[model samples]
Target chain A: MPLPSDIEKSFAASLLDKDGRVPSDLTSYSSPVPQSRFNIYRNNVHVALIDMMAAKFPIVLKLVGEEFFRGAARVYIRANPPTSAMTINYGKGFPGFLENFEHVQDVPYLADVARLEWLRMEAYNAADRKSLGGEDLAAIDHDRLIETSFELHPSLRLLQSEYPVYSIWQANIDGVALSSVDLNSGGEDVLIIRPRLEVLVIKLASGHCDFVRALGSGIALGEANERAFESHEGFDLQLAISGLIGCGAFTGFSK
Target chain B: MTNLSSWLDKPIPARAGVGLKPEHFAEILDTEPDIGWFEVHAENYMGDGGPPHHFLSLIRERYPLSIHGVGLSIGGEGALDAEHLKRLKTVVDRYSPGLFSEHLAWSTHGDIFYSDLLPLPYNEATLETVVAHIDQVQDVVGRQMLLENPATYVTFKSSDMAEIDFLREIVARTGCGLLLDVNNVYVAGTNHDYSPQAYLDAFPFEHVGEIHLAGHAEARDDAGARVLIDAHDRALVDDVWALYERVISSGVSVPTLIEWDNDVPSWARLFSEAQKADRILKGAQTEDAVAV
Candidate 1:
């Protein structure tokens, strides 16, 4: 860490620093390089991460608006500066950042909305695997099915939030008028999966979330069913399996 | 592992290619436009099998492909991220792209990744660092990579040698190919108040294996001096087109690509830019045939 090392550290620091400062060794053909020239590197770094965050969390951007969203994104980008160049993995901590981001506290549901968006992004880029279709699950013998444990798709994500995050995400994504949905209606259990290239965000029924979670954690199908039944009186095993299978949730199952 | 000799062959035909964008993925598959090749940022396709890989697989099957890595930070001050190198190798092994390339710039320092290609000074200490990194990259990826020059606004006061000399020395030491980006030369030349033609005259065209042509945004410095940003949002300006022709005229007819990373245009618009390069290359092809 000598000549170029000292220069890079300061240059990297100035890019993410709250106070805009130019590195000392920087020069131009002219006697003194204009500040704007050095600021180009600064702008490129900030603008790239900001744009990446803005693109990944569109629903959050809509809720907060561009001005506020970008302003907050600027601060978030600095505080949680990416350690990897993988833009997909850059904002994994953004939802948590928004949770404690003071200015958006009035909008208590903002962090949850951000969490839903982050999950959707994760689903989009997750590993590829052929999902176990409903027919495949049905073809299993009834006696063996009970003891079988299911392997969920690699892209499956379950998000439980106190805010009606699914509705907020759905409304914004579909470009529908938000007046139809009440933000304070109730919390939501979201099941996001991408069996193929298409990503699906499903609003889970009361007991299905626990059932799916249990199955995902290697519990036997029969035991998962029993857990679902205990979780809520409205639990219907047939309906839950049909819905999840219809959406290609499970990748495989083993006895 | 790819054979180093075969990697140096540069199998990508001396025709025009376009940067692949997800927005136009379906259209590209459906239309199957006549493109020389397609180049993608290795980081974009580092994601596991999904639409990016799905579409790239389809396109790679039809045409020659090049994987341009934007985030290896080859010129970084610290040790190169072995994980990032592994990711780059994975993508290369999956597709076996015709050309593999990265920048002469560093984007990450310490634990922070900037997500932008930050410029580095051209000097012995920095040169040793870059040469070692490129050597590590070629050894790990098991391929000959092309190193592209960066478009910079500021130069280091400590830089003892010129950019061309640094590039030539790196090529001599590492034996890697060069991806000569015409617009970058124009942009850097104007930004630094240097003659791009002079830089081109000094370039080691023998080691050059590919060409990159793109559009840059015009801006002004704080002192009101003209500065150009490598903003690949729009079409190539007439001046950059001339620079591309100049490179072709210099007997360096290589696989050219039109890179529109920001504000990506329609498939028709992007492909047409590639076609424009094809027209220029074709014109030079006829002249070379006559010369031969």
Candidate 2:
């Protein structure tokens, strides 16, 4: 018979528990001793996965000190154990977890910073494609330009936050000097893309984020212009399109 | 069977190879160090297309690559992870590595992946289970996979066989080569109160295709029992170097790796470690040449 789901969960929980014992039924020995060695294995697994999270999200850990970060991570891990052994992209729910966590409610921007880091990681590993060039844009007749739809680069990701997440990320970087960051400095829109082989996050101007978002959502060029115009009255379509192209944001276009 | 012989039996050059950490992408591309080969965790490169693929493609062109997997769970009670196996096979098919290896340990049980390499009782049950898993993995990848001995902390009372015997039986049954981790032998020996020398002596040297040298952390158990933990990326321990020398004397022409995945020092430090192993390989070759 297959192992029962609850029994398996209990078994895993027992192994991860600080004072829990390995089930006597699993082994043939009669010592009735606690599964101490198994607990060591369990601890190692948890620490390794936690370390991966810590590596990927260093700024998040730095925002919350080591003690609090690990404590919070332990809780998050038990609640949401990895669905796959491949942990390169695991811990996707960390940002949401931080938002709901009551301990760090004072630092409201923690989850947003985590979301930025996760987006950076995602862009770095997103699919590779041939980026559309400026010459391709010239191929279209000027009359057909606004009606054409464009496909954004596979690696393009937009992160809109109500806090200065970019400043938070920068201040906490390894070599950067730490300083008092302003919490109420309004909101920020960030553009994350892997143009070459590395993920680059560029802070977007207040009005340009809507342009990228509209373009990224596969809206027609005319509709994207309308959206950008609505948000920023004098939004320049030429400047935004050139910026997106230079950043390798569009892979191709469709009329 | 097609071109598998050349791959499994090919020799590795004596130059240094990096562990393929993502942090060094620009440095690796800029310097283009004359690295012998690059080794990476198989799971890392399983994605379809990304920076991992780009960097790997660039480096693969310049150096030999090896896929050292940590998640195969070769000794698990349940069936082998077929999806993970298929992903790994796709990678191997894409990049024909000079060597491919997995641990003689399990990591998953009914989808509750204990991401660490958990130990199994070295007995009939485990032996059969691992051998079957290795066979399945090899069949899928279409190549012989090297099995590295686990760096164990504790042994179960139900373990009816020695670790070496268990390894030998697997190799014999599956025709797989052994990735002899001298540090693991030394660490497991110290942990279990056995002789590292005896473990080495009992190892099937002819079947060892590659060797691993890494640093370990030594600590005491709850009951004050001394043991060594194989934390792979630390500074090289003095005794592990001695163990490497002893293994080189075994007359096996095996490619060795100076693995440092944690606390990774500078590129120069990793190269120096590899150079140290290179020296040992040459010394063994020199002695053999003089005897001839």
Candidate 3:
């Protein structure tokens, strides 16, 4: 005789598939409710997960509008339900989904905005470490400071997007009119970090992103500065160091 | 990480608590609500660290907490997700919560995790799977887990036992406790055309470690009969409260929680809901005192 788990196997298999039929044999033959009894599970799974995605990606929802966002979200959810039980970490693929979704091609920047939103959510919950401040750097001897390799804060996330992604995301976050984001203005290098409680989303200066990227790659500060200066004009080493330290970007450094 | 060695084993009192939310974090710290205790989804604090940790650590010092696991999927067929289990252990260690509980429903299959709690048929194989899964969870977290009965819309033909009997057997086999969700009893009863009182009557109240109360949304089945969805989006209805009062009248002073997961109301409103459960709990306590 087929074991109960074997019977449940058929029921569980089609539980979340959009096109799969519910295991009808398992339900009450005479359900007082006239509908397919299995539809309840279908509706519950779709609605709850879709709502979760909507909450996590509010900016994406705003850009696409509620109806449009929900529709796309439903498709995305059915195709890609959460892999892990930790749902707070769900929807990491939504940005990529939006990028490939044909209907939203007109709103190209929407995908990057979604990325920025995902990174912010990550920063909001990432592990905490004591962040470096200018004072901490000032206490270091000049020679040692230049040679010492810096550590990126645990919550730091850097994104180099080919859209005015930061401008679009900021506009939405502030509830400012979308008109404020002039997409024609070009792309942005966005830096996100939560040194303590508040998550900061920063638009970096010219070549500063290169400097941070170099440091993130385990490059020493002096070498990181050299790489930044070689890439872009007027990449001030002092300005970059001060800017990063001021925003609590790096943790303690080792010489 | 918290100082586990110095941790006090504070159990939940027979009073009402509310599910904690982020929007009310500041308000909760600013003006500590006079609620019994607070319950939070274990997954919410699974991340490495952030405001969730900062706020939870502070709140833990003041109030008793119950770590409710919504995603553990005790009823899952597959071996529980190892990564998710580690995350759960992290949360459990960080907060030596007064109580820990998970659903009777499964939320994962294969590699895919369904966020909603899905139903399961009662049978020998499932019963064995559930019992074994609960034992593993208890060993890993080093604590007892209260299994909450699910709100179901349908029953199975492959079932060999009643829901309460399945629960009774699980408790007997694994030494696990129960978390009786009053709202779920009402909702599941109405959905399956069963009697809520009968279900509660058969409940192993002695094994109940805690209680949950939430408001459900009403819908109609195809035949237009009432189907209650365990929505947890609004205030507890009067019928559910009446059932709760019945539980209280049975001389069980279990710690109760008012759970509002979606469309969460203001801290004051949610606190008032907790206060309502507290009133019922208090009324029963006073009557017991007089009889004694």
Candidate 4:
């Protein structure tokens, strides 16, 4: 008789391989077809994991259609089984999986869309905190403000992609009328945050993206604005600051 | 000891309650149905703070709550995951659910997690592993947990014991209670060609802390034999209802739960199912009173 760990290892391996045989130690009451009965478990595991991925990446499923999405998801799940029992945390590798997926090469933008969806899920579940307001920013002295670095909200996420992922995500998820997007219209940068309870995706100017990315990494205000100005020709510090504040991106600050 | 005493003090009433789904949050809060208690999957509320916790807090204020965990994998061969246990402890401390329960089957091996409850061979070795796992869980959570019997489609040849004996021994060793899932009994009974009644008769219902009744899907096995899958996506079948009535009539009226996970129906439909179970519970109480 095999040890319990040996049986478990074999069972886990067999769940991913179709030609894998059921362990000889297993038996049914009436029939000798343990292999046939084992298919039920294999099918259950696959279907459950595939459904979890589908729920996590609905826009990815929508782009690939159900049949293709299921096929791709099966491949992804076989390669990367969940490490945690929480289904919500199951698809952390899915966006990367789509990038290397041979079948999805035609839709190069699919991976970014998956990334957007994953970010939205993260933002939705991120720790809740009271956001800072415009008045709070105004309360700071000018000299100290330059030396102060603001803390971004826990729910805030920044993304820069080589495609117009924001428009594509909106079109697919919101059921907006599909319109042709210019691939040559430069790369897009987006800021995702949950201000209240709803996750909001805001398109950011290149300069603002640079500024927020720097500040998010603990850079002081003056240095962050300098990097923003160097990145874009017309970087408006006041406009960027006000826009991020309105989106509830910052929580508090320290010198 | 103090924590355990506090947990034991708030016992869920012996009536019917439905699994709380996010879809019915508004209706439940608005109508305030006379539910016995509410049960939630512990994994669903592991997040820091969101709508899941927001609504659950309001609902918990009104009714007694039970945390039914599906991810603990207590029957696995290796040591239980420490991080998973810590998260579970956090939730347990936060909610202080009247009853905490997990399945008898394993869902993880090494780092790979199969979300569904997978079957285990019933033998001395496996029994020892499970008892130890339960002991570890109980020690960490600071309270006793109810171990639920699993619905199996396949049996192992290496098994040297019966399911009832395995459960009985688990309770004897670790001092844990049982969460008798009646639908699982019916499903496993039909799939394995055993008498559900006989299984129930041999079961040690004295250790039962809660009861679960759910729906199963009907399918044919490879040999063209009839089998039932514990789907939990539909209403309870007539046969399962009959078995539940049998359990109640036998003077084992525990806290019952109506589990509807997938293809969730409207608030009215789900509440009606609970109402049906509630009526049976009332009938059982009346019978006991008359006997007394």
Candidate 1 local lDDT, B1-292, one digit each (tens): 3475656544789999999898998888888898888899999988886788888888888888899999999988899999999999999988888899999999989998999999888899999999999999999999889999889998887788899999999998998989999899999999999899888888899988888888899888877889999999999999889877888987888899999999989889898889999999999999999999
lDDT of candidate 4 over A141-179, digit per residue (tens): 897877889899998998899999988887877797546
Alpha-carbon shift of residue A129 in model 4 (angstroms): 0.8
- Which portions of model 4 show Cα errors greater than 4 Å? none
| TM-score of model 2 (CA atoms) | 0.90
- Give me the chain B TM-score of candidate 3: 0.96
lDDT of 4 at B100: 93
Runs off by more than 4 Å, candidate 3: A29-36, B1-8
Query: What are the lDDT scores of the predictions, listed in order?
Result: 0.89, 0.79, 0.86, 0.89
TM-score ranking, best first:
1, 4, 3, 2
Q: List the candidate 2 regions with Cα displacement exceeding 4 Å.
A: A1-13, A20-39, A171-181, A231-234, B5-11, B14-18, B23-35, B48-51
Best by DockQ: 4
Which has the better DockQ: candidate 2, or candidate 3?
3
Worst 10 residues of 4 chain B by lDDT: B1-10
Residue B48 of model 1 has an lDDT of 80
Two-way DockQ contest, 3 vs 4, winner = 4
